[model samples]
Target: MDRVPILKIGDILLVSIQIDMEDQVALQLQEDLAERIVATGCHGVVIDISALDIVDSFVGRTLATIASISRVLDAETVVVGMRPAVAITLVELGLSLPGIRTALNVELGMELLARARDEGVNEDGDAEDEPGTPAVPAP
Candidate 1:
Protein backbone atom coordinates (compact mmCIF):
# COMPACT_ATOMS: atom_id res chain seq x y z
CA MET A 1 0.00 0.00 0.00
CA ASP A 2 1.15 3.56 -0.68
CA ARG A 3 2.01 5.67 2.36
CA VAL A 4 0.35 8.92 3.40
CA PRO A 5 2.69 11.74 4.46
CA ILE A 6 1.70 14.18 7.20
CA LEU A 7 2.92 17.78 7.26
CA LYS A 8 2.62 20.20 10.19
CA ILE A 9 1.72 23.81 9.37
CA GLY A 10 1.36 25.63 12.69
CA ASP A 11 -1.62 23.85 14.25
CA ILE A 12 -2.69 22.44 10.86
CA LEU A 13 -1.43 19.05 9.81
CA LEU A 14 -1.40 18.59 6.03
CA VAL A 15 -1.63 14.95 4.95
CA SER A 16 -0.31 14.29 1.45
CA ILE A 17 -1.81 11.22 -0.23
CA GLN A 18 -1.46 9.41 -3.56
CA ILE A 19 -4.15 6.76 -3.54
CA ASP A 20 -5.16 5.96 -7.10
CA MET A 21 -5.15 2.28 -6.36
CA GLU A 22 -7.87 -0.20 -5.46
CA ASP A 23 -10.42 0.35 -2.68
CA GLN A 24 -8.62 -1.84 -0.16
CA VAL A 25 -5.31 -0.04 -0.63
CA ALA A 26 -6.95 3.38 -0.46
CA LEU A 27 -8.95 2.59 2.69
CA GLN A 28 -5.86 1.18 4.39
CA LEU A 29 -3.99 4.39 3.67
CA GLN A 30 -6.85 6.47 5.02
CA GLU A 31 -7.06 4.39 8.20
CA ASP A 32 -3.36 4.68 8.84
CA LEU A 33 -3.61 8.42 8.16
CA ALA A 34 -6.35 8.80 10.75
CA GLU A 35 -4.28 6.98 13.33
CA ARG A 36 -1.26 9.19 12.66
CA ILE A 37 -3.23 12.42 12.76
CA VAL A 38 -4.76 11.44 16.08
CA ALA A 39 -1.32 10.64 17.40
CA THR A 40 0.06 14.05 16.44
CA GLY A 41 -2.52 15.89 18.59
CA CYS A 42 -2.73 18.62 15.97
CA HIS A 43 -5.67 21.03 16.14
CA GLY A 44 -6.36 21.01 12.40
CA VAL A 45 -5.59 18.87 9.31
CA VAL A 46 -5.68 19.03 5.50
CA ILE A 47 -5.84 15.92 3.33
CA ASP A 48 -4.21 16.89 0.03
CA ILE A 49 -5.62 15.11 -3.02
CA SER A 50 -3.64 16.66 -5.83
CA ALA A 51 -2.45 13.22 -6.96
CA LEU A 52 -5.78 11.42 -6.87
CA ASP A 53 -7.45 10.40 -10.18
CA ILE A 54 -10.89 9.19 -9.15
CA VAL A 55 -13.55 9.07 -6.43
CA ASP A 56 -16.00 6.37 -5.43
CA SER A 57 -18.37 5.47 -2.55
CA PHE A 58 -15.72 3.52 -0.67
CA VAL A 59 -13.29 6.39 -1.10
CA GLY A 60 -15.89 8.86 0.11
CA ARG A 61 -16.71 6.64 3.06
CA THR A 62 -13.05 6.36 3.99
CA LEU A 63 -12.55 10.12 3.85
CA ALA A 64 -15.67 10.82 5.89
CA THR A 65 -14.65 8.25 8.48
CA ILE A 66 -11.19 9.77 8.73
CA ALA A 67 -12.65 13.27 9.07
CA SER A 68 -14.91 12.13 11.90
CA ILE A 69 -11.95 10.61 13.69
CA SER A 70 -9.84 13.73 13.18
CA ARG A 71 -12.57 15.89 14.70
CA VAL A 72 -12.54 13.67 17.74
CA LEU A 73 -8.79 14.20 17.93
CA ASP A 74 -9.42 17.97 17.95
CA ALA A 75 -8.19 18.33 14.38
CA GLU A 76 -10.37 19.65 11.59
CA THR A 77 -9.73 17.69 8.35
CA VAL A 78 -9.82 19.70 5.13
CA VAL A 79 -9.87 17.88 1.77
CA VAL A 80 -7.97 19.90 -0.81
CA GLY A 81 -7.05 19.77 -4.49
CA MET A 82 -10.07 17.68 -5.41
CA ARG A 83 -10.49 17.63 -9.18
CA PRO A 84 -13.75 19.05 -10.52
CA ALA A 85 -14.79 15.73 -12.00
CA VAL A 86 -14.24 13.90 -8.74
CA ALA A 87 -16.22 16.53 -6.85
CA ILE A 88 -19.10 16.33 -9.29
CA THR A 89 -19.11 12.54 -9.19
CA LEU A 90 -19.36 12.49 -5.39
CA VAL A 91 -22.15 15.06 -5.47
CA GLU A 92 -24.00 13.14 -8.16
CA LEU A 93 -23.75 9.98 -6.09
CA GLY A 94 -25.30 11.85 -3.16
CA LEU A 95 -22.24 11.27 -1.03
CA SER A 96 -22.60 14.00 1.51
CA LEU A 97 -19.52 14.77 3.57
CA PRO A 98 -21.42 16.90 6.03
CA GLY A 99 -18.78 17.21 8.73
CA ILE A 100 -15.85 17.48 6.35
CA ARG A 101 -14.08 20.75 5.66
CA THR A 102 -12.82 21.42 2.11
CA ALA A 103 -10.57 23.87 0.29
CA LEU A 104 -9.40 24.30 -3.29
CA ASN A 105 -5.68 23.81 -2.59
CA VAL A 106 -3.07 23.44 0.11
CA GLU A 107 -2.75 27.19 0.69
CA LEU A 108 -6.47 27.67 1.07
CA GLY A 109 -6.70 24.53 3.14
CA MET A 110 -4.20 25.90 5.60
CA GLU A 111 -6.08 29.18 5.68
CA LEU A 112 -9.33 27.42 6.53
CA LEU A 113 -7.64 25.31 9.13
CA ALA A 114 -6.30 28.48 10.69
CA ARG A 115 -9.82 29.82 10.77
CA ALA A 116 -11.06 26.67 12.46
CA ARG A 117 -8.23 26.91 14.92
CA ASP A 118 -8.99 30.57 15.55
CA GLU A 119 -12.78 30.94 15.13
CA GLY A 120 -13.71 27.33 15.73
CA VAL A 121 -16.35 25.52 13.64
CA ASN A 122 -18.88 27.25 11.39
CA GLU A 123 -22.69 27.28 11.70
CA ASP A 124 -22.97 23.68 10.57
CA GLY A 125 -20.74 22.58 13.36
CA ASP A 126 -21.49 22.60 17.11
CA ALA A 127 -23.25 25.90 16.56
CA GLU A 128 -26.72 24.42 16.08
CA ASP A 129 -26.67 22.66 19.40
CA GLU A 130 -26.62 26.02 21.14
CA PRO A 131 -28.58 29.08 19.96
CA GLY A 132 -27.73 32.22 18.01
CA THR A 133 -24.50 32.59 16.03
CA PRO A 134 -21.46 33.00 18.19
CA ALA A 135 -19.13 35.95 17.77
CA VAL A 136 -15.88 35.38 15.88
CA PRO A 137 -12.69 37.27 16.47
CA ALA A 138 -10.62 38.49 13.50
CA PRO A 139 -7.69 36.34 12.55
Candidate 2:
Protein backbone atom coordinates (compact mmCIF):
# COMPACT_ATOMS: atom_id res chain seq x y z
CA MET A 1 0.00 0.00 0.00
CA ASP A 2 2.85 2.35 0.74
CA ARG A 3 4.38 3.80 -2.37
CA VAL A 4 7.27 6.23 -2.49
CA PRO A 5 7.19 9.40 -4.50
CA ILE A 6 10.17 10.48 -6.54
CA LEU A 7 10.96 14.17 -6.72
CA LYS A 8 13.64 16.03 -8.61
CA ILE A 9 15.82 18.85 -7.36
CA GLY A 10 18.91 19.98 -9.22
CA ASP A 11 19.96 16.77 -10.97
CA ILE A 12 19.15 14.76 -7.89
CA LEU A 13 16.12 12.50 -7.72
CA LEU A 14 14.67 12.38 -4.21
CA VAL A 15 12.50 9.38 -3.35
CA SER A 16 10.51 9.30 -0.12
CA ILE A 17 9.10 5.98 1.11
CA GLN A 18 5.47 5.45 2.02
CA ILE A 19 6.10 2.60 4.54
CA ASP A 20 4.35 -0.40 3.04
CA MET A 21 7.72 -2.15 2.87
CA GLU A 22 6.27 -5.35 1.48
CA ASP A 23 8.30 -7.74 -0.63
CA GLN A 24 6.25 -7.03 -3.72
CA VAL A 25 6.65 -3.36 -3.10
CA ALA A 26 10.35 -3.87 -2.66
CA LEU A 27 10.60 -5.36 -6.13
CA GLN A 28 8.58 -2.49 -7.52
CA LEU A 29 10.90 -0.08 -5.83
CA GLN A 30 13.82 -1.48 -7.75
CA GLU A 31 12.07 -1.39 -11.07
CA ASP A 32 10.39 1.99 -10.65
CA LEU A 33 13.43 3.73 -9.26
CA ALA A 34 15.62 2.21 -11.93
CA GLU A 35 13.33 3.48 -14.64
CA ARG A 36 13.26 6.94 -13.18
CA ILE A 37 17.01 7.02 -12.72
CA VAL A 38 17.56 6.02 -16.32
CA ALA A 39 14.93 8.40 -17.62
CA THR A 40 16.29 11.41 -15.79
CA GLY A 41 19.95 10.54 -16.24
CA CYS A 42 20.56 12.32 -12.98
CA HIS A 43 23.76 12.45 -11.01
CA GLY A 44 22.36 11.39 -7.62
CA VAL A 45 19.45 9.59 -5.99
CA VAL A 46 18.21 10.31 -2.47
CA ILE A 47 15.88 7.75 -0.86
CA ASP A 48 14.15 8.78 2.35
CA ILE A 49 13.04 6.00 4.66
CA SER A 50 12.52 7.67 7.99
CA ALA A 51 8.99 6.39 8.23
CA LEU A 52 10.03 2.79 7.86
CA ASP A 53 9.83 0.99 11.16
CA ILE A 54 11.61 -2.08 9.87
CA VAL A 55 13.91 -2.97 6.98
CA ASP A 56 14.06 -6.72 6.50
CA SER A 57 16.29 -8.55 4.04
CA PHE A 58 13.84 -8.14 1.22
CA VAL A 59 13.81 -4.38 1.49
CA GLY A 60 17.53 -4.32 2.03
CA ARG A 61 18.09 -6.45 -1.04
CA THR A 62 15.74 -4.25 -3.04
CA LEU A 63 17.67 -1.15 -2.00
CA ALA A 64 20.95 -2.75 -2.88
CA THR A 65 19.54 -3.84 -6.21
CA ILE A 66 18.28 -0.34 -6.90
CA ALA A 67 21.69 1.07 -6.07
CA SER A 68 23.36 -1.42 -8.33
CA ILE A 69 21.09 -0.76 -11.28
CA SER A 70 21.25 2.95 -10.70
CA ARG A 71 24.96 2.83 -11.21
CA VAL A 72 24.45 1.11 -14.53
CA LEU A 73 21.84 3.77 -15.31
CA ASP A 74 24.47 6.47 -14.65
CA ALA A 75 23.12 7.73 -11.32
CA GLU A 76 24.27 7.34 -7.76
CA THR A 77 21.78 6.08 -5.16
CA VAL A 78 22.22 7.07 -1.52
CA VAL A 79 19.74 5.92 1.11
CA VAL A 80 18.92 8.82 3.39
CA GLY A 81 16.77 9.28 6.49
CA MET A 82 17.60 5.89 7.97
CA ARG A 83 17.16 5.81 11.70
CA PRO A 84 20.03 4.61 13.87
CA ALA A 85 18.21 1.50 14.98
CA VAL A 86 17.21 0.56 11.46
CA ALA A 87 20.76 1.03 10.27
CA ILE A 88 22.10 -0.99 13.12
CA THR A 89 19.69 -3.79 12.44
CA LEU A 90 20.58 -3.76 8.76
CA VAL A 91 24.26 -4.01 9.59
CA GLU A 92 23.67 -6.79 12.07
CA LEU A 93 21.65 -8.72 9.57
CA GLY A 94 24.78 -9.25 7.51
CA LEU A 95 23.46 -7.40 4.50
CA SER A 96 26.48 -5.56 3.31
CA LEU A 97 25.75 -3.29 0.39
CA PRO A 98 29.04 -2.81 -1.37
CA GLY A 99 28.43 -0.04 -3.88
CA ILE A 100 25.44 1.65 -2.29
CA ARG A 101 25.92 4.92 -0.46
CA THR A 102 24.19 5.87 2.79
CA ALA A 103 23.63 9.24 4.42
CA LEU A 104 22.20 10.16 7.77
CA ASN A 105 20.01 12.92 6.41
CA VAL A 106 18.73 14.54 3.27
CA GLU A 107 20.67 17.79 3.45
CA LEU A 108 23.92 15.98 4.02
CA GLY A 109 23.10 13.54 1.27
CA MET A 110 22.48 16.34 -1.21
CA GLU A 111 25.79 17.90 -0.27
CA LEU A 112 27.48 14.58 -0.90
CA LEU A 113 25.79 14.32 -4.26
CA ALA A 114 26.82 17.86 -5.18
CA ARG A 115 30.40 17.12 -4.32
CA ALA A 116 30.34 13.94 -6.38
CA ARG A 117 28.95 15.68 -9.43
CA ASP A 118 31.45 18.48 -9.06
CA GLU A 119 34.30 16.06 -8.78
CA GLY A 120 33.20 14.27 -11.91
CA VAL A 121 33.00 17.51 -13.84
CA ASN A 122 36.31 18.79 -12.52
CA GLU A 123 38.03 15.54 -13.30
CA ASP A 124 37.17 15.88 -16.93
CA GLY A 125 38.19 19.58 -16.86
CA ASP A 126 35.82 20.21 -19.69
CA ALA A 127 34.10 23.11 -17.94
CA GLU A 128 30.84 21.73 -19.20
CA ASP A 129 27.59 23.04 -17.80
CA GLU A 130 26.29 21.29 -14.71
CA PRO A 131 22.99 19.45 -14.52
CA GLY A 132 19.87 20.33 -12.45
CA THR A 133 21.29 23.31 -10.58
CA PRO A 134 18.17 25.51 -10.25
CA ALA A 135 17.94 26.74 -13.85
CA VAL A 136 16.25 24.33 -16.21
CA PRO A 137 18.34 24.02 -19.32
CA ALA A 138 16.76 24.10 -22.75
CA PRO A 139 16.03 20.79 -24.40
Candidate 3:
Protein backbone atom coordinates (compact mmCIF):
# COMPACT_ATOMS: atom_id res chain seq x y z
CA MET A 1 0.00 0.00 0.00
CA ASP A 2 1.22 3.47 -0.87
CA ARG A 3 1.17 5.89 2.02
CA VAL A 4 0.48 9.54 1.43
CA PRO A 5 3.32 11.82 2.38
CA ILE A 6 2.60 14.39 5.08
CA LEU A 7 5.04 17.28 5.12
CA LYS A 8 5.41 19.91 7.81
CA ILE A 9 5.50 23.55 6.80
CA GLY A 10 6.12 25.81 9.79
CA ASP A 11 3.13 25.11 12.03
CA ILE A 12 1.06 23.47 9.33
CA LEU A 13 1.01 19.99 7.80
CA LEU A 14 0.64 19.70 4.05
CA VAL A 15 -0.87 16.58 2.47
CA SER A 16 -0.66 16.45 -1.29
CA ILE A 17 -2.59 13.46 -2.55
CA GLN A 18 -1.15 12.37 -5.86
CA ILE A 19 -2.33 8.78 -6.00
CA ASP A 20 -5.61 6.98 -6.37
CA MET A 21 -7.25 6.72 -2.97
CA GLU A 22 -8.09 3.17 -2.21
CA ASP A 23 -9.94 2.22 0.97
CA GLN A 24 -6.85 1.05 2.80
CA VAL A 25 -4.83 4.04 1.70
CA ALA A 26 -7.48 6.44 2.92
CA LEU A 27 -7.76 4.74 6.30
CA GLN A 28 -3.98 4.69 6.67
CA LEU A 29 -3.83 8.37 5.86
CA GLN A 30 -6.39 9.14 8.54
CA GLU A 31 -4.32 7.31 11.13
CA ASP A 32 -1.03 8.77 9.99
CA LEU A 33 -2.40 12.32 9.99
CA ALA A 34 -3.73 12.06 13.50
CA GLU A 35 -0.35 10.87 14.70
CA ARG A 36 1.48 13.60 12.81
CA ILE A 37 -0.72 16.36 14.23
CA VAL A 38 0.04 15.20 17.75
CA ALA A 39 3.69 14.65 17.09
CA THR A 40 4.26 17.98 15.38
CA GLY A 41 1.73 20.02 17.33
CA CYS A 42 0.75 21.78 14.11
CA HIS A 43 -2.08 24.26 14.22
CA GLY A 44 -3.20 23.73 10.64
CA VAL A 45 -3.66 21.04 7.97
CA VAL A 46 -3.87 21.63 4.21
CA ILE A 47 -4.90 18.70 2.03
CA ASP A 48 -4.32 19.24 -1.69
CA ILE A 49 -6.41 16.93 -3.80
CA SER A 50 -5.89 18.62 -7.12
CA ALA A 51 -4.35 15.50 -8.61
CA LEU A 52 -7.44 13.47 -7.96
CA ASP A 53 -10.09 13.71 -10.65
CA ILE A 54 -12.72 11.79 -8.73
CA VAL A 55 -13.75 11.74 -5.10
CA ASP A 56 -16.09 8.96 -4.07
CA SER A 57 -18.43 8.92 -1.09
CA PHE A 58 -15.97 6.99 1.05
CA VAL A 59 -13.20 9.42 0.25
CA GLY A 60 -15.50 12.32 1.07
CA ARG A 61 -16.39 10.74 4.40
CA THR A 62 -12.73 10.08 5.07
CA LEU A 63 -11.90 13.70 4.44
CA ALA A 64 -14.60 14.79 6.85
CA THR A 65 -13.32 12.38 9.43
CA ILE A 66 -9.80 13.67 9.00
CA ALA A 67 -10.99 17.24 9.49
CA SER A 68 -12.87 16.27 12.61
CA ILE A 69 -9.85 14.45 13.94
CA SER A 70 -7.61 17.43 13.22
CA ARG A 71 -10.04 19.74 15.00
CA VAL A 72 -10.03 17.53 18.06
CA LEU A 73 -6.26 17.70 17.98
CA ASP A 74 -6.44 21.52 17.92
CA ALA A 75 -5.61 21.86 14.23
CA GLU A 76 -7.64 23.28 11.35
CA THR A 77 -8.06 21.47 8.01
CA VAL A 78 -8.59 22.96 4.54
CA VAL A 79 -9.12 20.86 1.40
CA VAL A 80 -7.84 22.40 -1.80
CA GLY A 81 -7.90 21.89 -5.58
CA MET A 82 -11.30 20.37 -6.13
CA ARG A 83 -12.45 20.39 -9.75
CA PRO A 84 -15.98 21.46 -10.66
CA ALA A 85 -16.92 18.03 -11.88
CA VAL A 86 -15.77 16.47 -8.63
CA ALA A 87 -17.86 18.95 -6.67
CA ILE A 88 -20.90 18.10 -8.75
CA THR A 89 -20.23 14.42 -8.31
CA LEU A 90 -20.03 14.84 -4.56
CA VAL A 91 -23.33 16.68 -4.55
CA GLU A 92 -24.92 14.07 -6.77
CA LEU A 93 -23.63 11.39 -4.44
CA GLY A 94 -25.40 13.24 -1.62
CA LEU A 95 -22.17 13.88 0.28
CA SER A 96 -22.02 17.40 1.61
CA LEU A 97 -18.72 16.69 3.36
CA PRO A 98 -19.58 18.39 6.60
CA GLY A 99 -16.74 20.00 8.59
CA ILE A 100 -14.53 20.32 5.52
CA ARG A 101 -13.46 23.75 4.30
CA THR A 102 -12.06 24.13 0.78
CA ALA A 103 -9.84 26.38 -1.31
CA LEU A 104 -9.03 26.62 -4.99
CA ASN A 105 -5.40 25.63 -4.59
CA VAL A 106 -2.64 24.88 -2.11
CA GLU A 107 -1.70 28.51 -1.72
CA LEU A 108 -5.25 29.57 -0.94
CA GLY A 109 -5.70 26.62 1.35
CA MET A 110 -2.61 27.56 3.30
CA GLU A 111 -3.88 31.13 3.53
CA LEU A 112 -7.23 29.96 4.86
CA LEU A 113 -5.52 27.84 7.48
CA ALA A 114 -3.24 30.69 8.44
CA ARG A 115 -6.19 33.06 8.77
CA ALA A 116 -8.05 30.61 10.96
CA ARG A 117 -4.97 30.19 13.11
CA ASP A 118 -4.55 33.95 13.40
CA GLU A 119 -8.18 34.22 14.49
CA GLY A 120 -7.29 31.79 17.27
CA VAL A 121 -10.12 29.46 16.42
CA ASN A 122 -9.77 25.74 15.86
CA GLU A 123 -11.78 23.79 13.34
CA ASP A 124 -14.11 22.82 16.19
CA GLY A 125 -15.02 26.54 16.54
CA ASP A 126 -13.30 26.80 19.92
CA ALA A 127 -11.39 30.00 20.64
CA GLU A 128 -7.68 29.61 21.45
CA ASP A 129 -7.33 32.48 23.86
CA GLU A 130 -5.13 32.68 26.88
CA PRO A 131 -6.54 31.68 30.21
CA GLY A 132 -9.09 34.25 31.52
CA THR A 133 -8.82 36.29 28.32
CA PRO A 134 -12.13 37.74 27.17
CA ALA A 135 -13.35 36.64 23.76
CA VAL A 136 -14.51 40.20 23.00
CA PRO A 137 -13.05 43.54 23.94
CA ALA A 138 -14.63 45.79 26.55
CA PRO A 139 -16.34 49.05 25.67
Leading candidate by TM-score? 3
- Give lDDT per model, in order: 0.75, 0.81, 0.89
Task: Summarize candidate 2's per-residue lDDT along 18-123 as a digit string, tens digits.
Answer: 6777777777777778878778778799988898888888777778888888878878788889888988898899876667788889999998888887787686
Q: What is the TM-score of each candidate against the true structure?
A: 0.74, 0.78, 0.83
lDDT of 1 by residue, 1-139 (tens): 3656667766677777784646676667667666766676677778888787777777777778888877777678889999988888888989866777789999998888777676764645777676576576799
Candidates 2 and 3 compared by TM-score, better number: 3
Q: Model 1 misses residue 58 by how many Å? A: 0.6
With candidate 2 superimposed using the best TM-score fit, by how many Å does residue 77's alpha carbon deviate from the native?
0.8
In the range 20-102, model 3's lDDT, one tens digit per residue, is 88889989999999999999999899999888899998788889989999999999999999989999998998987877999
In model 3, where is the ten-residue run with the lowest total lDDT? 121-130
Q: Model 3 scores what on Cα lDDT?
A: 0.89
lDDT of 2: 0.81
Candidate 1: which stretches are off by over 4 Å? 21-31, 121-139
Candidate with top lDDT is 3
Sorted on TM-score, highest at the top, how do the candidates line up? 3, 2, 1
